[model samples]
Target: MSAEGSRAAQIKPFVRQALVCPVDKGPLLDAGDELYNPRLRVAYRIDADGIAVMLADEARKVDEAEHQRLTA
Candidate 1:
């Protein structure tokens, strides 16, 4: 099998279970060959078909920063 195809085969299960839009904490919908977060307006392309990635928004960053600040 081609590299891309093999990668996709490995990623399919993880994508189905673990891939969620970090910004909204909601399920990402597959958009053609890619995945998209409607709330964050970010599109994630599978890396070499093996890893599903999601870009978090500024709100998440701020939340994380605040969390760290509180913990510190």
Candidate 2:
């Protein structure tokens, strides 16, 4: 596996079932470099430096079209 992939795998256990969305207090899906909330249609980016930015303000609001595509 690639280095990025390995890092993501390693980080998965640390965040999975642990991290939650600050805005809605909902569960977050660990999508490699991004933590996504399908219920709220928001995505928080994981920095290349290994920092998980869980702040709502730092998250991107996914529009209806993208949300459907992502959740589907």
Candidate 3:
């Protein structure tokens, strides 16, 4: 591959590494089951067992403090 292409590939991880949650400025965690947004108190689960579920609104508010610490 070209030098520019290799350089771009190397930078991809760094670019993705720089992304942090807007709410808490903390790292987002992949809980295997889902991607939990602690600040928003939401857990986005995809393809769980056999169903795709989105935890939002009141359901997402179940563990606000726990999620915050997880993200932090």
Candidate 4:
């Protein structure tokens, strides 16, 4: 598997339930190493260490198409 995919596999089960969007305080879905919030149109990066950087400043604001893709 790709590195990101591998990382996701390792981190998803441990962190998925605990991840939340720091901006909107909403649940996040695992999108590779990023945790995405469809409602907020943002994605938070998971570090190589398997820790999520959930800070708002660390979040990436996705466009509508990307949001749809991530959510899908």
C-alpha TM-score for every candidate: 0.49, 0.73, 0.35, 0.78
lDDT of 2 by residue, 1-72 (tens): 453573344565656568789998988765556778998889888777767788888899889987776566
**Of the candidates shown, which would achieve the greatest TM-score relative to the real structure?**
4
Show where candidate 4 strays beyond 4 Å: 1-6, 12-14
Candidate that beats the other on TM-score, 1 or 2, i.e. the better one: 2
- After superposing candidate 1, which stretches have Cα over 4 Å from the reference? 1-10, 57-72
Question: Backbone clashes per model, in order?
Answer: 0, 0, 0, 0
lDDT of 3 at 10: 34
After TM-score superposition, what is the CA distance of residue 30 in candidate 2 from its true location, in Å?
2.9
Clashing pairs for model 3 are: none
- Predicted candidate 4 versus true structure: per-residue lDDT over 1-72, tens digit per residue: 574565455675656666677777788877787778888788888789978787898789899888788777
Candidate 2 wrong stretches, greater than 4 Å: 1-12
User: Which 10-residue window of candidate 4 scores lowest in summed lDDT?
Assistant: 1-10
Better of 3 and 4 by lDDT: 4
Evaluate model 3: give its TM-score. Answer: 0.35
Cα deviation at 5, candidate 4, in Å, is 2.9
lDDT of 4: 0.76
Clash pairs for candidate 2: none
Stretches of candidate 3 off by over 4 Å are: 1-27, 48-59, 64-72
- Indicate which candidate wins on lDDT: 4
